[model samples]
Target chain A: MHTEAGPKRPTTPVQKGLQAIPLIINVISANFQLNQFSSLTLLEFALDSSVLLLVGGNRGRCVWATPMNNIIAYLFKSSLGKKYIMAVTGCCLFLFVIGHMVGNLQVFLGPEAINRYGHFLQSNPELIWPARIGLLVFVGLHFWSAMQITLENRAARPVAYANSKPVAASYASRTMVMGGLIVVSFIIYHLLHFTFQCKAINLTGQDFVGFTDPNNHHDIFKMIVVGFNQPLVAGFYLLSMGLLCLHLSHGLSSMFQSLGWKNDAYRPIIDCGAKVVATVIFIGYSSIPVAILVFKFGKEALK
Target chain B: MNLTLKVWRQKNGQTEGHFETYPARDIIEDMSFLEMLDVVNEGLISSGKDPIAFDSDCREGICGMCSLVINGIPHGGHAGTATCQLHMRRFKDGETITIEPWRAKAFPIIKDVATNRSAFDRIIQAGGFVSVNTGGTPDGNALPISKEVSDRAMDAAACIGCGACVAACKNASAMLFVAAKVSHLNLLPQGEPEKHRRALAMVTQMDKEGFGSCTVTGSCEAVCPKEIKLTFIAKLNRDFGVAALLGK
Candidate 1:
């Protein structure tokens, strides 16, 4: 299957060994030589030949050990491959969001519970930092791949349509970039307001109310109460949540489709599931601010 | 009726193109879109000017050769109808119709309104066919197929490679085209043996040709001359996943 029509000059021991395993060589070298040689020839050659030599066995047995690594590598070099990357990273971020929401829900359980939870997270610096680093990687990859694909898609159609009309795509799907930008900005604001306690909000300063729990913890419960009490801050959070909902409404289902998990039988379920999850997350997160502002449940916690 | 036409004119793939206006006089409501173009071309030739260049074959929708994005919609944006099948009655008299070629990186304009769609042929060559042996014809009922299955297969088989899906797509994705080809063959019993291989090969070729990824916009189905459904893209995705995981 090696299409090199020249003489079969096997120079290296690896080439000779590969020649002996004709069946395995044919299957591996045929498709691999055609497509993958351009980018991954050296890597695949060194890896596969070394593995074959290490296993030194009957040719028939060795033939079963053709390397599929190059095929995957080659597949990922294309636009579709980039999309698969985005889907995977997006799923990771989705999981992170769900986990964060679950943790935040402990705030409704009162000061001790939420403070203990916050203390548990902060106390494990090694685990928490590594998880944070991993999440940052996912976010970076998700954003980078998204930007790359969007630019490529835009370049594909340079000339704008004079009277364009969308038939199949939803408003949410079309506005993903806008919503994503809003969510990213909100995340920065969120980290500053709560996690870092940046000077912008000046939480510990005289201008803002500051409270610590009995254990002298950062009093995350009181901090959340004071944070949401500000109408502007609460309004920004509510608006960002709405945008996040819009982003996830399309993104969740699209992630499945991008990863090739969609089929006619389960398409409706996946689409509806995306909408439901987005709405539920929106309502769930929005409830905290609504309860703080309207019902004033956390007023005493702030004091 | 008289109609004003703003036709895009380009020398070739390399040079820039611009819109050139022309008046099509005494255009009857009965004339097909291509026939109206032909009349306008005849007038241009009689007046010692170069005629407009476009691609058309069979003058019916089946050929898939007639390609024009009229007023920003591929194949006149009429569902289930090609540019050749579009009649002049659809447009109002004295209205200016804007005609442009299929604008996608994969499809370069060879001239005015005619693009090189060989990228599509390359995708087909990648593995759009079954590996059946040549022999005497099998019995009519040799392969048992349910009516629903056959109809669905036929529905996918109706894709004419018109590139309207690409033209209409926001991303210029040919997912509908590739999906139709993959689904039509894979749905049949005769194509069962090479199902996984076909899916992998065709999708790989599609990406290699520089077509953008499908975001499931549904515009391709909306503008397809065959009205090919978007579900075929979903099937293609399914087959691609299975093939990538398990196929040789």
Candidate 2:
């Protein structure tokens, strides 16, 4: 549809047939910036059309547009809409946390293994870049919805009771905001310590980017080993893990409730399962720092 | 028994409120909390002073008219009890007591310990009803509702709308109240036809009323005079999600 001449642009009959669809044409013509049209991948094209279908009204005068607009209004401007967003994003972040913990656990497999895995991920920009952007969007939406809910909650109770007392809400459930804020702070510090390889914040007085494994990949093994070898660093890591545990303990089950996946029959199981999973995650994550700091598992490799 | 009372004294919604201390003398242990208040207010009126004002109806627990936060606990923190049902025997003699109104932006305080809870009526008016034909009462057996379904509906229908759940919730959320109202109708055959519209409209009206969203904190259920379960909120969430996704 664009005037740009690029090899990546679709030329085959099937792709041309797919482009013949009027809705995609409408979305491309109506919404996207002029430059973005040339580089639109199949995934981007599908995602944009669906979003436009829901938001911009169907085909400019389609019969389904009214209900779609109402649904969009409900999702965007209502209390339950904010809740649905939080629960969905919270689920995404929860899955990411599990994946990250599994990836970090690979450090136990020794230098070559973990470094190779890191290299594989780092080298794939096409895959990693999209995943990274999706993750950033999820995090942003999660935190933004949380902030809106928190502020609205505060405004709902403008007058304070003289002697308010909590009856059944757990401490972890009550302190979600506080723990979430701390976890966010830890995420920033963690990205700097490892992902960015910023030496000044690592407190080791040595830059981590220069370190290389025998095969010349970035030595994630050595960086993690040296980083957590310091008691203060490991201690902070442990503390953040504890907060993460607290956050997940309530969040996991609460996510189910918010999404309407929870019911009275499954309440006990969901609640118990959440705590168990949270504890398992804590143990899995904390083991790495403890091994590096206390057991000196990888200290010999540093020399 | 004699007790010192520190009660919230507000002239009206537009004026500032404060605590005015008074001695509650010769209160019998068998008297209800409202009876004790009545005695105290009598003394104030005898002295030609402004008496404490609060809300109460049916002096029994079922009307859901009584709203008070005693010592920071809604409905005196008694399980399955409204403020009217809270007896003086629950308190110790020669002790100090604190009483406040149901505190929430939506349930604005009209006077001392009394609030304007008509916001709830407006919410119910939004979509809490099913369209029925005007006729003589239909035979109950016409709708073959199974025992389990009817019982479940009854459980949700137990909500008294006392506003205690709102008072007990830190966020002053009306989720439990809305959930109960929505579920009782949604589960029944009569309410099935309007289910999607009811869920969508009631929640929209609830948000419009400025109530906070549910944080899944069990505080509302804990202090609910009718002991409405927190699971109903999940039911509402589930229903709302389906209706919204289906564009109903």
Candidate 3:
């Protein structure tokens, strides 16, 4: 009965949990690997299994569900579905960006204070990693869902148009993937430079040497100042934040539509508000490095 | 009246479309909007360039073939007015009028402003028709539908598949068009047999066509060009809900 019950889903928490485990494994394994087997090995396994399933489908075996038939309704039918997913993720991401910007704004509190804050964050590993994991999963899901919709859009129109003008899609809409990739890259490069110990990135200090950020608070703040004091690092940070701002401009309003929250009455007002908010928040963060650059080295600013 | 027209031109779907500024100097105020476009096309042809192609027929505003988005408003910004009935008098002399076809994911640009509105036809054909026998030469008013029901049906039947609702909606939702058909038929006793099937089939087809969902934005009604109320969508939602609950 137990063995038979395993196959008999649609009931029982145990069976549901069993069914759910593979999903969790698949989701985590699909992401950027931290250690152990490389992504390529997993890719080969996934490809081989999917192909086997495809070939096996020709026989009288059952497949879980028709992928197209199940999701096509939401992806194809309603603009609200698109807006809903975009909205939920956008709002969440916005909250995170705002929080991040606030944290980074500590740079203006003077080097010692900023360094102490960074130390506090570093010391609280138990708190930080879990938040990071949640953030990573959400970001992954948001991007995956977006990619699915964009692909569906392309499928509706197969013939390539060389001269066909795209509709009034916002800059954020068109640049979602590009901005996302840039941010992802920035995150990795940033972590390696400040958090992770890759030799190329850890030029200023030994990675993790300030261990829980700098107790005297001097070294931690000095490290951050020195990091931004470099014109090259400052430029990259500013550019990434610019992209994040552009993404938010479209993402906020678009997400509202996805979640079925927007109407003609509220859409325009919210869209404009999003644009203004995105610009302000992004510029607020970008201003830090610019401030550092100006106050510290504006006399030789361009130099 | 002198009219300067800025029209979107593209040779084909594969070609790039651009807004070309043209002058419609010495035009009569009484001519229908199509007639003004004809004058512009004539000017373009006289120069050996290709004439602009647009949809129109039954120029009296009944056929619903005239699809035009003028000055960022569908059907020249008039409520309950078809593009063909829109006259040159609506514009000032020397007005730089901009014209383009309805832009929506569901409606592809076939040529210039002419789109493949066959999508709407497919939706209707999916389940809009009633199952009736040929030999039943039924007497007039044999079904004895209530006056309110008949009037409502007539209102729904008035939809000419013009794609105006799509043009009017910000998300380009086709709910008004779909609702009109569903409501008109479902309101009558004759259509009761397939009410559930009709609603489901039409909605499925609509989604299949990539038309956006209805948020009851009321933009469709505001710029309907026919003043088709959004009650049809309400009727559709009710039908679908009942049908799904009944496990039909």
Report the number of the highest-DockQ candidate. 2
True lDDT of residue B103, candidate 1: 86
Give the candidate number with the greatest lDDT: 2
- The TM-score that candidate 1 achieves is 0.84
- Residue A266, model 1, lDDT: 82
TM-score of each: 0.84, 0.88, 0.58
How far is A43's C-alpha from truth in model 1 (Å)? 8.5
Ranking by DockQ: 2, 1, 3
**How far in Å is the alpha carbon of B84 misplaced in model 1?**
1.7
For model 2, residues B188-221, the per-residue Cα lDDT tens digits are: 9989999998999899888879899998879989
Pairs that collide, model 3: A83-A257, A83-A258, A83-A259, A84-A258, A84-A259, A86-A255, A87-A255, A163-B15, A163-B16
Off by over 4 Å in 2: A1-69, B134-137
lDDT of each: 0.82, 0.86, 0.68
**DockQ of candidate 2 relative to the true structure:** 0.67
User: For each prediction, how big is the interface RMSD?
Assistant: 2.4, 1.0, 7.5
Give the per-residue Cα lDDT of candidate 3 at A20: 48
- Angstrom error at residue A138, model 3: 1.8
**Model 2's CAPRI class?**
medium
Better of 1 and 3 by lDDT: 1
